[model samples]
Target chain A: MQITVLAGGVGGARFVRGLLSHLRTRDDAEQTSVTVVGNTGDDITLVGLRVCPDLDTLLYTLGDGVDEGQGWGRAQESTRVAGELATLGVGPDWFTLGDLDLATHLARSRWLAQGLTLSEVTARLAQRWGLPDRGVRLLPATDTPIETHVVVDDGEGGERAIHFQEWWVRHGASLPARRFTVAGLGEAKAAPHVLDALRTADVVLFPPSNPVVSIGIILGVPGVREALRGTRAPVVGVSPLLGGRPVRGHADACLAPLGVEVSAAGVAGLYADFLDGWLVDDADAGLRYPAGAQVRSMDLLMRDTEGAARLAGAALDLGRELSPVGAGTRGPR
Target chain B: MQITVLAGGVGGARFVRGLLSHLRTRDDAEQTSVTVVGNTGDDITLVGLRVCPDLDTLLYTLGDGVDEGQGWGRAQESTRVAGELATLGVGPDWFTLGDLDLATHLARSRWLAQGLTLSEVTARLAQRWGLPDRGVRLLPATDTPIETHVVVDDGEGGERAIHFQEWWVRHGASLPARRFTVAGLGEAKAAPHVLDALRTADVVLFPPSNPVVSIGIILGVPGVREALRGTRAPVVGVSPLLGGRPVRGHADACLAPLGVEVSAAGVAGLYADFLDGWLVDDADAGLRYPAGAQVRSMDLLMRDTEGAARLAGAALDLGRELSPVGAGTRGPR
Candidate 1:
């Protein structure tokens, strides 16, 4: 089976880990392949280094080098560089980057400065983590620069837009966001192999990640949504919300700014144009989704790797059941 | 009094610290201003950051942040970033850059990228360390790229040139250097204020630094040597050698490649055309020097900051004695 996932940072990383674990247990695991199209809206330049938080999170988590406690950044990381940078009065003091993580940014930024695409740089980093050895491939959603910015009240009569990281990390998303703007979205095309991954995949899964910025940013790319709508694969999505609150992060805050109800059905409706199957928490089982999509309820909270694997298994089952050709089509793409 | 000193790394840093201490004890201490022309020949781009080892040493040593025990680098420094970079296979594994030091480089590189000259960057860094408040100014010998490379046997049959840092730090200068070449020397002009500092000085001193690479490279810059020769201020130098061996670093090895005897007289002879006075260790007191230059023997070893100050006081007294118009000829230029 060829499974492709649209992922964000922490939540998507956990889901991808679970999905990889689920595939590992199958007898024909060698025949299974996974491709992850990671969100690039969260990328930022810190101290002249290009930092892709979501991509680094995925690599560190899957490579077993992530700090499990924080659910992001490298294990055994030190903030000496960041502390010194603060002492030097350079960069944003609020965004604390670890020394080991800064090395990744340095390497990636150097390569990018040498004219490599984001997809190429991501592949180089993933290879260092041996992602390919585990039958997994990670690519950015778009190679073009596409940053997510939040328009928030500047605390006076007017409003100003700030980088998504400033809103999420610095402000804790406390300030009311007037709207979210995807900068460069109109010019961004899917990264190399992204369209192909969607078009040729047996199944596509959206993990319990923020619908607006994570998968939504990926869908915002010029050709991504068209690829999903035209692909023969069944697209399945898991709810990022439970009991009208996010399982992790401030997905509710993100949805509220868009005037969308903070519920499973609301998240599902955002993807109703292409979503064939939707998975919500048991608490939200009775919530009505769009007409054509098959709805199911299961344990969606990924508390641990084992829980993630179980959740991933549930999503896979739903995607397989929704496929017109069923489990093993044996068709060569 | 306006004093200008030519400096290198560790030894020069120790000498400058002593000079500052000597000036501090004077009644007109606040009136004494010192300008140091730092060697940039040892600089290398490690991991894309322009690292000036000598300049950093001068800043850290005077700023009380240097590792006193090691005589270079920051105190209580961590190499977490260097370790991570090695793991990523990004930079030279043998050259370990501490996390705190890397911050300086990153800030400098970022500023340089933003179009700041190396001299401007050095001043910015010095101000951060409060050097300006202490009446000390540090400037690079030249703003142009003038790296020293040593031609050595490739260990096969032919010879190849390698960066001075690689030759010094990695090989420990074990390979016999056929000759030393200062790359970009022809194009390197004295950095801003170098000539002004030299020409308008009450006295000029050459601290016991490596003659071949450090002070030699500085003199090689167009107009620097001419300024020293034309300046009315008495030029005095402290020997970096004591019994035919340098107080610190591989000065002897550097001298050997050029057939210059690693002795006090040999070093003083190189500057005979411009030097008005030379200070050698008591052990080499009987040694003969070139004509027209007064020679004195003193305790040149800077065992501590106090010892360094005493030595610096001796150099100042010798410079005053050599001046045609004695000590208090405070004539307006």
Candidate 2:
């Protein structure tokens, strides 16, 4: 079976890691291949180096090199380079690049500058992390340099746009976003194999990532939404929200500008057209979901690797229940 | 009074630092200014970041942040970035960039990419080092991207060119060079203020730097040698050699391909056209020199800052002795 996953940073990375852990115990582990399409909306050029926070998070988490405490970045990371950059006043103080993490940016930036596509660079990076050996392939949603910018008040009844990172990292999303704008989204084509991954997958999984900026940004890519809607695969998603609030990150802040309710059911409504199975936290089990989607409730707090694996197992079980082999029709779109 | 110095890396930086120390003890220190024109031939782009070894050495040494033991780079430096790059197979493993040192390259590369000339970037970097407060200004020989390439045997019975750094750092300068070819040198004009610094100075000094690659490369700049020839200021130099041998660096290897003798007199001969005074070690005091230039002998080993100061003091005294006020002619070219 080929599983396609759309991922963001921390939450998405953890969920996929859990999926891998769950698969390791299954007899068909060798037969299962996973393709992850990472969100590039959070990409930014810091100090002339391209930094893809979401992609790096996925790489580190799945490679078993992620910081367990932070759930992102390299384990045993040092901030020597960041400290020096601060002394030199080169980059923003809010966003720090760890010494080990900087190597990834350097390699990515150099390769990009040399005219290699982002997909090609990601593949090279994935090799170093042994992703191929684990039957996993990581790719960017789009090769074009697309960035998510947040529109905010300019403090005098006017509006201004700031890079999403500044809004998310520097301000902690405290500034009310009027709307989110993704620069170059219209012109960006889905990266090589991205649409194919979605179209041919047996199961499509949406990890508990930010619906507004992460998965939404990926869907914004040209043809991506159509691929998801048309794919014969069973599309299952774990809600990022529980009790009208996100467990981590400012997903609520992101959804507020879009006028979407900050709840599990509201998030499922965003994917109502293609979603086959929806898994929500037990606290929101009573909430009504979209029609035609099989709703399931579970203890969704991924407290540890085991907890994450259990949640992943439940989501997979939900996906299998909705798969054509079980009961649902797998008719051509 | 204004003093201009042509410098390279370690030896040149130490000489200028010593010159500053020597001037501090003099009564006219407050009335004097110094300008340093540094060689850019050694500059290379490593892992997409511009690395100016000579300029960085000058900045770190003069700013009191240099690694005293290595005579270059930052103090208390860590090679975490380089180690990570090695693990990722991104950059050359032979050349290492310390975490602290990488920050400088990042800043410089970003500024350059933002359309700032190399001179402008150097001025900003100098501000961080407090160069203006010390009445010192540092400038690159040229703003154009010029690199020195060494033509050596390919070991397949053919000649090939490699970056100067590859020959010096990776091969330890052990490869016998057929010649040195500087890419973009002919078209590169002298950077802003470089010619003026030479033309208007009361005295010009050549520190104990490599004659073939460092100071020699600076002279190769279009108008620089002409400015020296036309300037009325007495030009004095301290020979990099002690006893027909360079105390540090591969000056001898650099000179060999040009068929120049690697001795004090031979180095003096290279600058005979503009040289007004030459300072050599006591061992080479009896060597024959060009008749127009004044010669002085000294215990030229700079064991510490004090010894370097003593040598700088002697060089300055020789310059003053050869000045028009002290019986030497100071007329138009």
True contacts kept of each: 0.67, 0.88
Candidate 2 residue lDDT tens string, A1-333: 788999999999999889999989998898888999999999999998999999999999999999989888999999998887787788898999998999999999989989999999999999999999988999999999999999999999999999999999999999999999999999999999999999988889999999999999999999999999989888999999988899999999999999988899989999999999999999999998889799999899988878888888888888888786741334453
TM-score for each of the candidates: 0.96, 0.97
Cα-based lDDT at residue A137, candidate 1: 98
Residue B25 in model 1: shift from native, Å? 2.6
Query: Interface RMSD, all models, one decimal each?
Result: 1.0, 0.9
- DockQ (CA atoms), all models: 0.74, 0.84
Worst 10-residue stretch by lDDT in candidate 2 chain A?
Answer: A324-333
Candidate topping TM-score? 2
Clashing pairs in 2: none
